[model samples]
Target: MQQLSKSHIPFFVVLVLCFTPWLQSPSALVLGLILSQLGWVPTNVPIAKWTKKLLSYSIIGLGFGISLSEAFKATSSGIGLIVTTIFVTLILGTWIAIKIGLDKKTGYLISSGTAICGGSAIAAVSPAINANANQTGLALAVVFILNSVALFVFPVIGHALNLDQHTFGVWAAIAIHDTSSVVGAAGAYGEEALRTATTLKLARALWIIPVALGSAWYFGKGKQKLQIPTFIFLYIAAVVVSDLLPQFETLYHMTFSVAKQTLVACLFLIGSAISLEQVKEAGLKPLLFGVGLWLAISIGTLVWLLY
Candidate 1:
């Protein structure tokens, strides 16, 4: 009789367990944290240092998450303009990010955030773009920082313009990067904005599946094969289940927390890997590229959303 390989069992478990409807967000986060931290599962790098830093910075997520949820509940009114905003902004922003010399990976990450759900979009795309852990970490850092800033700033902007909740929702979904941040910003503005922003962000999140498949096809055919991030399905499944259980919908928040923690750990690993010397040695090329692309995407996305 032939025996099953040990690796196959783990693979099967990952595939099956992740799909179970009972699995919650926090559960996934815990699993990811364990796998990333311990040797229980392997990663391209160790994340202990990064995770520590992330924990320190996580107040950003905690504040952003609760506010964002509040915004969604309050803004149950707008729908049409929100869609238009997301479509227009994404196209413009992506073009700008790419034009500015941001490497394809960083450019895509920034654009995805502005165009869709922020950090989640970047997190979803990082692996597909073959981004180094550092690149992912840096991009995540930028998004969260921006989200925190937006939380403080966006409502003021909306108020200055005297924009209605629906308009602000579209703006938040189009311009903001993490859902929590979007929620925070939108909620600050109004409930109409929150609902619109969340719906639009969710719509944008769907893009990851196709993008992942396309990326796998694009990069895998060459000598360097890329693995699709199948774990995203866990996020999707969690969303679906959360939607079905309004009574326990906060479970999504738990997942969000978990994902945020894991991501922080990932960022810590990235920071440890990044050397001041390497940033200097790259002789401004990568820095130029990264910054330029980010600005370009930002401008382009803004144009698309507005025009």
Candidate 2:
């Protein structure tokens, strides 16, 4: 058998990953998980760290895509629902975790993901809570899997219920765990739904800052400084700059699209880092907790928002 060198394989994998045509977040997510399980890549590769940084950059790019003024208009209409659903989900998710004997940190991670922005929320809050990579991975896996299902399923349900574009957009923004899937589902519905959902979801994503600080306080033992997520501020700045610069609109849209694509690559990195040990650490309880909390937010919010 011929021996393959380490340097060449990763470069090729990365190249192919970069160019893969259908490399959306869900696909990238699946590919990453498969690679990790197969043990194809060595553990020493810094893709995980780099991917995390790329994700932050992607958020900044995401800001350029969303006009702050537009976001505020959408946000103003649904601010009460977004805020209430997030806090309620957080409290209920934590309560269920405690009731089921799940890890509190895991509960918080899952809840944060469900409440704010799926894997992005997990990424933002994990460091604040001092969660290990494996812990964050587990929470992300739970949320990512659900986001995939919701991406497709949500549209069907919306149509079945005959929800108006704005209503479905609000419902999706309130219910879906990840921004990508929330946008995906809404985009499937219509451009108006997509616009409304994206704006509302980004505004909802703004909650990550406070949630991270809250995590630091509640989970950390000693006195903790209020560590903020810097990327969020950059994200806001991008939104403002893009909105202000009329001539640069074309470039801004292109960059935002590139940012979303990079985020898919980031998902691949995140998926690759998920070890069996991490999955085992997650266990049945946390998964169940995720399921319960997701159902609560999905069903509960759907009823309240639609009616």
lDDT values for all models: 0.54, 0.78
> Model 2: how large is the Cα RMSD against the reference?
3.5
For 1-307, candidate 1 gives per-residue lDDT tens digits of 3344543344235424544544432344444433434333433323444443443233223322333333344334434444444455445555655565555565556555555566555656666555665555445555655667778887887798687787677767766667777788888787788888777665555555455456556546765656665554544455455555657646657755655654544443444444445444435444343344345544554455556
Residue-level error in angstroms, candidate 2, position 140: 2.3
TM-score of each: 0.60, 0.82
Reference-based lDDT, residue 254, model 2: 89
Summarize candidate 2's per-residue lDDT along 1-307 as a digit string, tens digits: 3344663375448536753556666667667777778766565567657766776787778777766676677678888988899899999988888888887888889999999989777876776676755666678778878888899999999999999998898888888998878988999999999888888897887777678777777875565555555776776688778888868998998898887777777767777777777687657877778888999989998889656
Each candidate's clash count: 25, 0
The best candidate in terms of lDDT: 2
Determine the backbone clash count of candidate 2: 0
Best by TM-score: 2
Error of 2 at 305 (Å): 3.1
Q: What TM-score does candidate 1 get on C-alpha atoms? A: 0.60
Instruction: Count steric clashes of candidate 1.
Output: 25
